[model samples]
Target: MTDRKLALAAWESLFRAQHEVFHDMLADFDGTDISQAEYDVMLTVTRSPDMTARLRDITANMLISQPSVSRLVDRMVTNGLVTKCADPDDGRGSLITATDAGARAFRAVATVHGRSIAERMSALDDDELRTLRALSDKLRRS
Candidate 1:
């Protein structure tokens, strides 16, 4: 193969391996009784620092439908991980918020999952880590 073709093949293989690694990390997260989808929502909500997110915003960020967002929020609330409340700014709309319990659970999951990931990547030296980050950023931009 040409040099460019060989490089492209290596990138594809690494990307697939990265996907598998993510799948493994998500296999056991129980925070909010969340699937990968719900946990993603939770992360976005919690990071916003407003302590709340609109249903529409969540749907947009999650790339899900309104009905699907509602269902996911309902399930999380039932599991004591989230709360759904009418938006004060617009009573017709709703917002989703994570409870204290939800934050705690998310933290716990992050701890375990982060440790597993760190351990796995520990073998890579600092230069390898930098290369990985640069490649990830490049792919994301592309």
Candidate 2:
């Protein structure tokens, strides 16, 4: 049996916590060459083999709409942070690859961002983190 009141309370707490944490973490991007969105895009791209990823894959991983991702990718390309080209296998799709400059920028911000995340998450113990991860994953899956 599920308690509706309890569930709603839990959801409200979770949402508020996430919002606050995200807001605080926004500082990590300040003075960086790339915005958070660009970092997110490159996070997907650099993780892929050869530092390349399908545009569709990037779009899938992002929270923004497909058209927004396309526009952002174009801006990234113009800034020389990444290269974009038509996908070889999918004529209608595109591929995004991080340029050397882009990779460097990502690494720099990632180092600072990783530290910031660790510091913030230190509020929870390792076991709590594992539990949080599991619960978050379960929610996403559901």
Residue-level lDDT tens digits of model 1 in 1-142: 5599888999899979888888877766744345677677787778766678887788878767778888888888998888889999987888888899887777777677679889778889989999999988997788
Q: How close is candidate 1 to the true structure, as a TM-score?
A: 0.71
Q: After best superposition, candidate 1 residue 29: deviation in angstroms?
A: 2.7
For candidate 2, which ten residues in a row score worst on lDDT?
79-88
In model 1, which regions exceed 4 Å deviation? 1-4, 30-34, 55-70, 86-94
TM-score of each: 0.71, 0.98
Q: Which candidate is the best by lDDT?
A: 2
TM for candidate 2 is 0.98
Q: Count backbone overlaps in model 2.
A: 0
Which one wins on TM-score?
2
Error at 28, model 2, angstroms = 0.6
